[model samples]
Target: MHALIEFPSPFPEEPGVVRLLEPPGSDIEALRARLRDGSYGRPFVLENGGLRALHFSLGYVQSVMKISDPCALQLGYAQRMTAFLLFNPRPRQMVMIGLGGGSLANFCHRHLPGTRLAIVEIDADVIALREQFCVPPDDERLQVIHGDGADFVRDHPGRIDVLMIDAFGPDGVAEELASFEFYERARGRLSASGVLVMNVAGNKETYARHVERLLTAFDDAVIAMSVREDGNYILFAFRDASFAPRWKFMRAIAIELQKRLRLDFPGFAQQLERGQALRLAQRLSA
Candidate 1:
């Protein structure tokens, strides 16, 4: 269903794309450099079988969005992260420390109409592809900043209601984002009722280090639920150490959210409680 255009351009022209549609938007040179030089292991987008995905490596997929439905989170880890809604379903002020393909950002912008969102991303090249991924442009409720996530959390002016950090690099969570200092700063950046959600990656040893730092930084008020895909773990750390969630209520919220957001909410609710219990029992036995 594609008609090749009788036109000339530095890049391959899209099939069936004849006219400008509107005006030239994306910086062709930026994209070209990323393609030409590999952009020093920069993330790339792949489109296949009606799905578009962000790839950090040939074998690893960081994020995926349906071309037919962009905001729908196609990755299991991302869906697990949405369990944050179980903690704070309606956050007024939110800060997200990554903008991979804007799955969370786009969903927040479209669905959470009352919340103001500020997204900080370290890669400008990735930010440039926002339009390509259907990420909405900056507006009153949204601002995507090209900056280091650690610095953004450190220098954030005031406490926020919710802070979600999913910033990861090719190998794993970047060194800066995984450090004790960063977690402390993230704790300081949250309000009294704030919750911090992070997508944690690593094997046994690295995972232990991350858990230790999170427990120390947030005073041991952290809960983790494993997303059985690609070994991704979602961590929920509370700024307030005494904040305890009841299982019955959480399951109720999970049911409601599953109906609304199309994620495995009830499953996450059950898993988180069980995981926390297992950890506590192991500690007591020790």
Candidate 2:
């Protein structure tokens, strides 16, 4: 671990100065060369008191983890991803697109022991930092693949119970990962009752475009919850149109999951319901 250095934030309104710590001899020139070659951007660690965060660039915080409890999820969207359990409480197999700091992967590996996890991350540098993020090693139940998420989904159809799309580059979500055809391929990879969850980070236009693509792919069997903290949207699209939203039953499941996983699952479910209602009203008015 590198010594923590007090790093000033470019944003004046930001709460506190970040403390960055980078590994020694991590060649900046080499990373730049890789970036030029269309490889992943360099990743660094930031700390603010006890809170530790991972970033590929100063513009975005990829993942956050509590240094004391590395396994615990510290981001709102990450906890919201657990809402996937509401759709399939006990999924046989889960496929994750991105492995940024392995927040979702680590939590699911620890909490959902019975479920098998396969994470697809394009960046090898990000994967190399798995130890720093406390990512679990691959076993029979957990496997991390260094590859393109879109290609993985295209090759494996109808094999995933829960498919999560969180792949992103420094600028935003990867272009290929966010396209309409990619979503269609993702939909084709879902089982009969599978659920696809995606974490989208961008402006209103970008969010709308991604949601529209999901709606088109799933035939409007999609709902979304917004993370007020970072303006990130968590989208859920179901393979089965019959999987209706029953707030009462979902609330019950949320309560149960909260007790088991120690997360605000009920709160997340409520947010999803609220977002769904707001979107429905917008559609009706339009």
Candidate 3:
């Protein structure tokens, strides 16, 4: 029988759980090769065990490649989007483009209870490996579709209240995904009052250039949240107009969510503020 491996968490668990597993070896290139050859999916530690990596399944959708030395979700992109949209009760139809470990999707399925959730991913092997982890299946609220996220939404005619672009490729986001044509298709898949959340990585300043492209498709766009130094940022774009975040309300919701999820709310709140402030500063500098 295979041995069960367990990892340890360094942070206070309130809003979410953070775990760091032991490292497989020192050779990352070998590890990447194994992944390419379909042999590696187990979790491993890096940076002298300060950082960790894992293959989180998206519940029969796709696998999210996560490097969690800093405990960043989507490298910290989802942190901001979760703060803004998690409590927004208006989105009954939620579509997620990427399904890494089903974190945001599972959280919504468990907490919202009434929302219909659909995740689109391109990899079939990732779907087959989901049960190897703990992602549940046969849920009435959640459905996993096997296909390219961009194409799925492009062909999907129904209106979506919230459209989340979480898809990422080995070379980073595909060229077609960040293209103006894809953004237009995403806009067409949304309702009049819909909010589009996109997760992006790399230089924060260069991120605005991508946002500029999205603005062509969206009437008004806003950087809902951003993290400094970390390669992840979450941008929330509106179909008709941008919606201002209610900070006090967001704080209240963050506190409540932390309590309900048994996670440390203080850190979550600080991260939210940091993300908002960074974006504001970036806007001023630009």
Question: Which candidate leads in lDDT?
Answer: 2
List the global CA lDDT of all models.
0.78, 0.80, 0.59
Q: Of models 2 and 3, which has the larger lDDT?
A: 2
Per-residue lDDT value at 213 in model 2: 80
| lDDT tens per residue, model 3, 1-286 | 2222332222222112222232444455554454345455543222123322234321112223343312234434454556544436547888888765555665667666778888886766445434433345847778888888878888886999888887764446777678888888888888877878887776557456677789767754554555554546667777765555566767777677777754544455566566557766876897
Stretches of model 1 off by over 4 angstroms after superposition: 1-40
Of 2 and 3, the candidate ranking higher by TM-score: 2
Model 2 residue 269 lDDT score = 85
In model 3, how large is the Cα lDDT of residue 30? 56
Error of 3 at 223 (Å): 1.9
Candidate ranking (TM-score, best to worst): 2, 1, 3
Per-residue CA lDDT of model 1 for 1-286, tens digit only, reads 1111122222242221111112245555554454444452656566656776665544566677788888898788888887778888889889998898889888888878999999999877677667757899889999999898888888889888889998887767788988899888899989998999988876768667977998899988888888776688888999999888888988889998888878889998888898778767876897
Pairs of colliding residues, candidate 1: none
Q: For residue 44, give model 2's deviation from the true position in Å.
A: 1.6
Q: Which window of 10 residues has the lowest lDDT sum in candidate 3?
A: 9-18
